[model samples]
Target: MDGQEGKATRKGPGAPRRNWRLYGVTAVGLAVVCGVAAAVGQVVRAGEASAVEAPKYAVGSGGGTKLDLPVRPTVPVTLTVYEDPRSPQSRAFAQRYAATFSHLLASGQLQINYRLVTQSDKQYGGSGAKEAAAAAACAEDQGRFAQFMDQVWQHQPAPANDALKDRNLLTGLAKKAGKINHDAFTLCVDRGQRNGWVAQSQSEFAAAGLGEAPVVQINGRPLPVPPAQLTPAELTSLVSDEAQRVATAATP
Candidate 1:
């Protein structure tokens, strides 16, 4: 279409075009099935896995040096998300039910873990996904991992693989988070300092033999839901019910 058409097309000549807002709104329902899929061809090519010595350390996954909320329930229920920043399913899930996770985190009822997977680089043919993972880890070091991640998902780049690979935009997001020191965050990202840690985190996820991104696990077991069909209320109810269940079980 011509510029006078008053439209911004993500596609070029001869490519099928669609409305960006409608596409984004409709794409909000994408979901990834939770399971250890047997597809094992993908690998993290960014950096070598270094040792993680923190008693509780991870990027967004609970515990360690990662991005974990301060939820200290005794005998806590765990929610680990093996996710990728560029995964459409993860974006969709965030678009719809991120508030539910936020509510759960506030209640301190579950130990949430975000295990990042950069295999989308292999699946999508670029290093953007992998670099995004590292950038997120840098945010973790700056104490904005949780806030920064919510913002990332909330305002993810369109066409996940390509636009999100920009290093400047990724670091700029940290600056936008406000809590993170922009200088440190910038240096961390620019120097690719956390790439090794990000690689190690992804390595752990791969070694666990998990499937694709947006893999949800509760108590170290897969928790599958039809992301397209799930409602926020239902998810919050599920969290409440799980909290009660854990409390009851721990009483004995």
Candidate 2:
């Protein structure tokens, strides 16, 4: 997560390879899940979760980012995740917490805002990061950001491979996501409508001084621990703590 020095606001240093150890949460510590049991229709890794009739969230666009909001508003703790699609660390973080995040969204307790960046393209020497990000943006337009994101990361190539630079591969992966309109996605990729937005978003990421990919924030604050060291139960605790703080502040 080291930041590259002497870089302009448009790009930053690429994230280094790091081993994101998945810490296991003990059964006793998992008691916190009880608070949001209603959202846990069945606990399963998000990568393996079946495609549903609809998205888990009401996907939308704003501020050069994709927004995933709960079906109904509740305390509203927003998780703003800045990610470079080509970064393996970002992939690890996303997949590791997918199911926990799914439950949080289902319980109407959290909102997720995904900010896509392409620093990895500069680091890895290809347009894959940009291409993948814009494709996700197009998916957002079609209300399939969640599904596209899951499939994209699950199918991410090696950090140096840059396979996503091929439009056919990108479009093919979209098709595999199901529910997404292949024709619209293909047209979006050809037109590159979201490319500029992707660039603008990268600029914002640079300006924000965010050091690396998978930079996660809760209610506008950085996570207490690095995303790699964070476990699902710890994330749940953090979100619930934020919810309580918001609730307390509003108590009259």
Top-scoring candidate (TM-score): 2
- Runs of candidate 1 exceeding 4 Å displacement: 1-75, 224-229
Q: Report the Cα lDDT for candidate 2.
A: 0.85
- Candidate 1 lDDT by residue in tens digits, 2-93: 87454444345324344666666666634222122222212232222354444353335544465554545664878877778877788787
User: What is candidate 2's lDDT per residue for 1-252, written digit by digit as tens?
Assistant: 234434543243332212212223444446667646734644544535753434555566664333575554558799999988899999998889899999998977899999999999989898999999999999999898888888888899998999988898888888878888888888998999999999999999989898989999999999999888889999999999999898888789
Relative to the true structure, how large is the alpha-carbon lDDT of every model?
0.72, 0.85
Stretches > 4 Å off in candidate 2: 1-72
* lDDT winner: 2
Task: Report the poorest 10 consecutive residues by lDDT, candidate 2.
Answer: 14-23
* Number of backbone collisions per candidate: 11, 0
